[model samples]
Target: MSRKLISSGSEFERKIGYSRAVVDGDYVFVSGTTGFNYATNSISDDVAEQADQCFVNIAQALEEAGSSIARIVRVTYILPNRDDFQPCWPVLQKWLGEVRPAATVFEARLLDDAMKIEVQVTARI
Candidate 1:
């Protein structure tokens, strides 16, 4: 199949020149997604809440890519603080408990200070 781009209508997609997700052949590659509520353009201070929102954003992109979170084969989590990772476990379990895709985590600075967590995933379409 030809490559397809999925957009979330986030201004960053325009400014940074990246789609929310890209579908190529049997796989869909989702971009690193943050917790900012696109509707409100605001983020929460709570890490867990941010984690949950990350999944929400991911699910939307996957859906647009003709896939679902259940189809995810790989996942990567990025956090600005290592200590913030544990608090996001319950939220992670809530979204990925069954699918349990191969995962990795990294502690690194994000583009914005308000972003506590970012998630990226690859899924089958």
Candidate 2:
């Protein structure tokens, strides 16, 4: 199939020069998403809440790209503080249990202090 771009309507997408997700052939690549509530442009202060929102955002991008969480084949979790990782496990397990895609986690600095978690995924359409 030809390339198709899916957007989450985030202002940063154009400013940063990237789509929220891209569909090429049978693969859909979803960009790393944070907990920033697109409606309020605000992120949660709690890590677990942030992780939950990350999945919500990811689900939208995947669904819009003609894919679903069930189709996800890979996932990546980016956390600024490694200690906060365990608190977010239940949120991850809840959303990822069915797909249980290949996954990785990293402890790295994020752009914003309020953002404790960011998630990215890949799926087959």
lDDT of each: 0.94, 0.92
Give the per-residue lDDT of model 2 (tens digit) for 1-125: 89999999988899999999999999999999999899788888999999999989988988888889899999999999999999998998899988889999999998888889989999999
Off by over 4 Å in 1: none
lDDT, candidate 2, equals 0.92
**How many clashes in each structure?**
0, 0
Clash total of candidate 2: 0
Report per-prediction Cα RMSD to one decimal.
0.7, 0.8
Evaluated with lDDT, which candidate comes out highest? 1
- Per-model TM-score, in order, reads 0.98, 0.96
User: Residue 113 CA error for candidate 1 (Å)?
Assistant: 0.3
